[model samples]
Target: MATTTEADIHITKGHEVLKLYQFNTHTARHYFCSVCGIYTHHQRRSNPQEYGFNVACLEDVDPFELGEVPLGDGVNHPADRN
Candidate 1:
């Protein structure tokens, strides 16, 4: 059977808000939140340097406020690509 580890956790936070951005495919941009001491999802750091997706199970996020957004691919680091 497969195993679940701490890395598999969807929701993660630090002392500050993380500006998660995308670098390429599998990597995400991680930053710290300065205002509320949380980690907001952005993109990936090793991916394409863009805010593509967010954690499906985050907190205090207003669905009506955000609306329905599309999803992109983020499975591989840029350097690892051909």
Candidate 2:
């Protein structure tokens, strides 16, 4: 996954097939491909100013190339505590 501001990102193609998913508090907007059911990106609940995008789902991106990536432990979401 990668992080970027909403204004910095734009789906050039296949955006028509993307569907929004909202669970729990519904503050975070998760988007996925309606046809393939692959996660695309999400407006982060932790930081609404940024979006977390699935690198593998994007074009010309090979997640394998980003070896030894560090990720957050999302097992305890801040919203869940509330």
TM-score for all models, in order of appearance: 0.26, 0.83
Report every candidate's CA lDDT. Answer: 0.44, 0.89
lDDT of 2: 0.89
What RMSD value applies to candidate 1? Answer: 12.1
Residue range 1-82, candidate 2, lDDT tens digits: 8889989988989989999999988989999999999999999988888998888987788899888998768796546676
Single out the weakest 10-residue window by summed lDDT for candidate 2: 71-80
Give RMSD to native, each candidate. Answer: 12.1, 2.4
At residue 14, candidate 1 shows an lDDT of 52
List where candidate 2 sits over 4 angstroms from the true fold.
72-74, 78-82
TM-score, structure 2 vs. true: 0.83
